[model samples]
Target chain A: MVPLYWYLWLGSVVFAVGIFGFLTRRNIIIMFLSIELMLNGVNISLVALSHYMQDLRGQILVFFVIAVAAAEAAIGLAIIIAMFRNKATLHADEIAEMKG
Target chain B: MVEWFFGYLAGAVILLSILVVLSRNPVHSVLWMLLMFLHVAGLYLLLNAEFLAATQVIVYAGAILVLFLFVVMLLNLKEELRIKRFTGGWPFRLLIAAGILIILKKVLDGFKVGFKGPWSIEAIEQATHTKALGKVLFTEYILPFEIASLILLVAIIGAVFLAKKRLRT
Candidate 1:
């Protein structure tokens, strides 16, 4: 079997990719997807650690994180929809109207 | 054969994830993400966290991603997502991402790593994840669990309140 650190490497790579996507993407929805990617990356590491440590606390934490992620997505999407109604575009660049 | 299978699966998952990240169409990206989630669930099974694997599918695939698909459809964003556009950051962000990966690789490589705890493949076989995890969670982590549930409940209420358009007059 491969070492546990290898899993950590995979998780970190995914996390970095997610971070890059979030930073580069203009669309709010894509940004949300990137956040999900980061969360899933963390989930992978957590579950791996849980398995390796022979503990369930990590899994339990994942449960809570998932709950929070769902709630955040719901509320964020609602806000996005509201904004879309008032504004024609979903591009973050288009949000410059708020500039002081 | 095992190594080949793992390699292929990992490659497929990564490819789908990249597609999910790059695809302009939100619906297509969401579908790709669903596939990526399924692959991740498979990875959990390979890690021997069967209970976690099931939860990954049920919670992530069944619930979270479904919600994403719903919002994508509800917003009627198919044409809107097709507009070819990007944020302010372009090639610079990718350069930084590569730099971070390289630095991380070097740091991780420098560590003299050994599994300090009982993490053998054989040791994992004896420990039932669901049973052992339940025992610990209920006995030691009970307080934390209750606290988390309470917080989630409050968040749920907050979400409902925020989603409401107007106060009843």
Candidate 2:
């Protein structure tokens, strides 16, 4: 049997990779996909814990998280499209209107 | 026996996620993400989450990544595809990611789980994971379910409104 901590470690590693992508990657779409990666990583840990602990709450939370992620993807991509329309660029560095 | 399988899935997940991050071409990144999502669903199946495994494939792979690919192709991002993969001082960002992982490890070392629930593996298997999940979702968590539907509703309207062409005002 695989130890549960291995799953936990995988979760954290995946999340960290997502963070690395989000921070370092300049492409807006990649940054957005990185957020999705982070969510998936967290879901991995939650499901592992829920399975080990014999709990349904974690799965429920994962369900809601997936739903919310779907919603977030719709809204986020729409915004990305709108931004690309206005700015004509996908580089996050160029769109510094929010920066001081 | 299972350890080897777990190792393969884990290694694939980690590697694909890294590739998703590092690939210069956005379409390649999306395809890599598709592979990573499948491996992750495999992990879910290993954990006795058949429903989530299915949902992961259907929702994430079928729906979400398709949205990403649609956007990637629709946007015609020819210029950004050829540029450097990261912004300036990317090494520092890598350090930051490593630091965060270290912190996560330290924090997880002290983690202790409490209070086991009644949904044992056998119980779930007897009732089936889907039935039990539906029972709890429709009964105890009905309110939140409604809220989630509302959230999706809002998302639908919002996405349409935001993406729709508007005349200059």
Model-by-model DockQ, in order: 0.50, 0.84
State the RMSD for candidate 2.
1.1
Q: Evaluate model 2: give its lDDT.
A: 0.93
| Candidate 1, DockQ score (0 to 1) | 0.50
lDDT of 1 at A99: 97
- Give lDDT tens digits, candidate 2, residues B1-169: 7888899999999999999999998889999999999999999999999999999999999999999999999997788867888888889999999999999999888877777889999999999999998988889999999999999999999999999988889
Stretches of candidate 1 above 4 Å error?
Answer: A96-99, B112-127, B167-169
Best by lDDT: 2
- The window of 10 residues in a row where model 1 chain A has the poorest summed lDDT is A50-59
In candidate 1, what are the lDDT values of residues B1-169, reduced to their tens digit?
A: 5556556666767677778778878888889888988888887887777877788789888987887788777776755757765565668998887788788788767755434454445654566567666766788788887887777777677667655676569
List per-prediction Cα lDDT, in the order shown: 0.75, 0.93
Q: What is the Å distance of residue B135 in model 1 from its true position?
A: 1.4
Local error of candidate 2 at B97, Å?
A: 1.0
| C-alpha TM-scores of all predictions | 0.87, 0.97
Docking class of 2: high
- Model 1, A1-100: lDDT tens digits are 6566777777777777787888788888888988998888888878777767755567778777787787777777777776776675678777886699
